[model samples]
Target: MELALSVLQLAVRILALPVYVLHFLGLWSWICKKWFPHFLSRFTVMYNEQMAGRKRELFSNLQEFAGPSGKLSLLEVGCGTGANFKFYPSGCTVTCVDPNPNFEKFLFKSIAESRHLQFERFVVAAGEDMHQVADGSVDVVVCTLVLCSVESPEQILREVLRVLRPGGAFYFMEHVAADRSTWNYFWQQVLDPVWYLVFDGCNLTRKSWKVLEQAGFSKLKLQHIQAPLSWALVRPHIYGHAVK
Candidate 1:
C-alpha cells in the first residue's frame, strides 16, 4: 500500500514537471511579463464590474481613510495592472512599486483611465527592497494579492512597516491558506509545488496573517472571507487594515 502511494505521488509530480521547468527557467515569467498583464487587465476590469458589490465593500475601507480630497500619499506594492486605481479618491497621489517591469506599461495605461488619482512615479522594485521610497513617506500603503507570492513575507512586511508614516495604515487583500479540515486544504498541500510553479510562486499554504502579526503592527484588523470557490487553490482570503 505504501509503495502504491509513493508511485502515485511520483506520478503526480512528474506530470507537473513541465510547469516547473518553464517557470524557473524564466520562460513563464517572460510570457507573463509580456502578455499576461493585458489579459489580467481585461479580466479584472470585467470581474470588478461584475462583482461590484464585493469590490466596493473591499475598497470602501480605503475610501474612508483616503477621503475624497485625494491629498494623501499612497504607495501600492505589486500594483498589478493598477487594479486598485479606480478605487482611489480624487487627487490622491500614488507611487507604484512592482518587481515585474512588464507591469509598468499596463499600469500607465490604467493610470491614464484613472481620473481620480495622480501618478507620481513607478519604481521597478520588489516589495522587499523599496529603498527608493523613503521611510515614513506614505500615508497609506496598499498591498492587494501580493504577499502570498513574494520571496519573503517577513522582509516585505518589514519594508511596509518602514515606509508607512506613523499611524498610517497598510491595507491588504490577500488569499490565504485554507482551513485544514477541508479537502481543498489537502489538495493545496499536495499540489503546492506545481501550483507555485504555474502561478509565479504563489504559495497555497501561506499563513499571511501570522506573518502580519509577527511584523509588529500597532493595530491589525482582518476579515476572513470564504468566497465561493471558483479556484480551489485561492479561495480563502483576508482583507483589512494593519497600522504601523
Candidate 2:
C-alpha cells in the first residue's frame, strides 16, 4: 500500500510535467491564457446567474469575508481571465499572473472602467515562483478557482503567505474535497486520470484548506458546499478568506 501510494503521488507529478511544458507553447498558451478562460468564465458567470441557488449562495457566503476596499493592493496568482476583479473597485489595483505569456497586452493591461478600477500588469509565471513582487508588499492576495490547476497547492499557499504582509489576508475560492465523504475518494480516483488532460492538471479532490492550515495560515473563514455535480463530478467547492 505504501508503495502504491508513492507511485500514485509520483504519477500525479509526472502527469503535470507535460502540462507545464504545454504552458510554454504560444499556440496552446493562447488557448489556456485566453480562449479557455473566455469560455469558462462565461459558463461560470452564467451558472452563477442562471442557477441562482447553492452555487450563488456559496459565492455570497464567501464574499462576506472579503476585506473592505479602499485602493487595496491586490495580487491574483492565477488571474487567467481576470473575471472576479470585475467586482472590485478600480481603486483596488491587481497584479495578475499566469503561465501563458502570449496573452494580448490589453488583456493584461490594467484598466479602470470606473475611477475605483485599477489594473496593473499581467505576468507570465506559475505559482511556484512570484519573485517579481517583494515580500509583504501586497495588502491582500487572492486566487480564485485556481488552486486545483496549480502544480503544488501546498507550496503555492506558502508562497502566497510569504508575499503577503503580516495581518494581510488571503482570499481564495476553489473546489476542494468533501470531508469524510466517499465522494472525496471517489472523485479523486475516478477523475485523477482524465482531469490532467481536460483541465491542465487541475485535480478534483485536493484538500487545500487542510493544506493551508498546516502551512500556518490561521483565522480561516471558509464555506464548503456540495454543488450539484455537473462540470466536475463528485467534487465539493470552498471559498474563504484567511490570514497569514
Candidate 3:
C-alpha cells in the first residue's frame, strides 16, 4: 500500500508540473490574492458561526495581556481578509501581516466594520520572514488556518516567538493530518498535490501539532477537534495557545 501510494503521488506531481510552473511564475498568487479573499470572507461567516464557542474560549484571556495603554498589542500573521477580527477582545491594537499585498483593502474593510478593535498597520511579508515587525513587540500573536500552508511552520513559529514579549501568548487554530490508521489519511496523502495547487500551497496532510510541540514554547495547551467544514479533508483540527 505504501509503495502504491508513493507511485500515485509521484504521478500526480508529474502531471501537476505545469501548474506548479504557473505558481512559480506567480499566476496563482495573483489569482489568490485578488479573488480568494472574497470567497473566504463568505466562508468565514459560516466557519466563525460554527467555531464561535472555541474561539471565544481561546481568546478569553486577551484582556489579561493589556499593557499600560489599557490595550493589548496583537499581531496576526497570515491575517487573510482579517477574518479573525470579530473574535478579538475590544481595545486590541492589531497589526496584520500577510504575504499578499492585495489583502490590504479587504483588511481595512474588516477594520472599518470592527469598530471595537484598532488597526495599527498591515505589513506585506511572509509569516516565516517578518523582519518588518520588531522583535518582542507584541503581547499576543494569533494564527488560524495558516500553518498548513506556510513554507515552514517551524520558521513561522520562531518568528512568532521572536515577536512576542516574554510571558506573551500565541494562539493558533489549524487543520491537521488525520490519524494514519484512518482511511482519511490515505485520501489526504493522495489528494495533497492537487489540493496544494488549487488552494495556494495548502497541504492536506500536515501534522501541524508536532511542529507546535517542538516550537520551544514555555507552556503549551493543545487539543484536537473536528471542525464543521464542508470539506472532509480539512475537518480534523487542532487549536490552543502557547506562552513565550
Q: Who wins the TM-score comparison?
A: 3
For each candidate, what is the lDDT?
0.81, 0.66, 0.89
Candidate 2 — which residues are off by over 4 angstroms? 1-35, 47-70, 102-115, 183-188, 228-235
Error of 3 at 120 (Å): 0.6
Q: Which segments of model 1 are wrong by more than 4 Å?
A: 1-9, 23-29, 46-51, 63-70
Model 2 global lDDT (CA atoms, 0 to 1): 0.66
Off by over 4 Å in 3: 3-26
Worst 10 residues of 2 by lDDT: 57-66
List model 3 lDDT by residue over 152-188, tens digit each: 9999999999999998999999999999998888889
Q: What value of lDDT does candidate 1 attain over all alpha carbons?
A: 0.81
Q: Could you tell me every candidate's TM-score relative to the true structure? A: 0.88, 0.72, 0.91
State the lDDT of candidate 2 residue by residue for 1-244, as single tens digits.
4576557756775767666466546444445545565555555665545334543443343333335453477788877655565555434667887775543343443243334556676768887798888898787787877887788888888789888878788877777766655645654755465565556567776777777677787678777776554565534777767877
Q: What TM-score should be assigned to candidate 2?
A: 0.72
Per-model root-mean-square deviation over C-alphas: 2.8, 5.9, 2.2
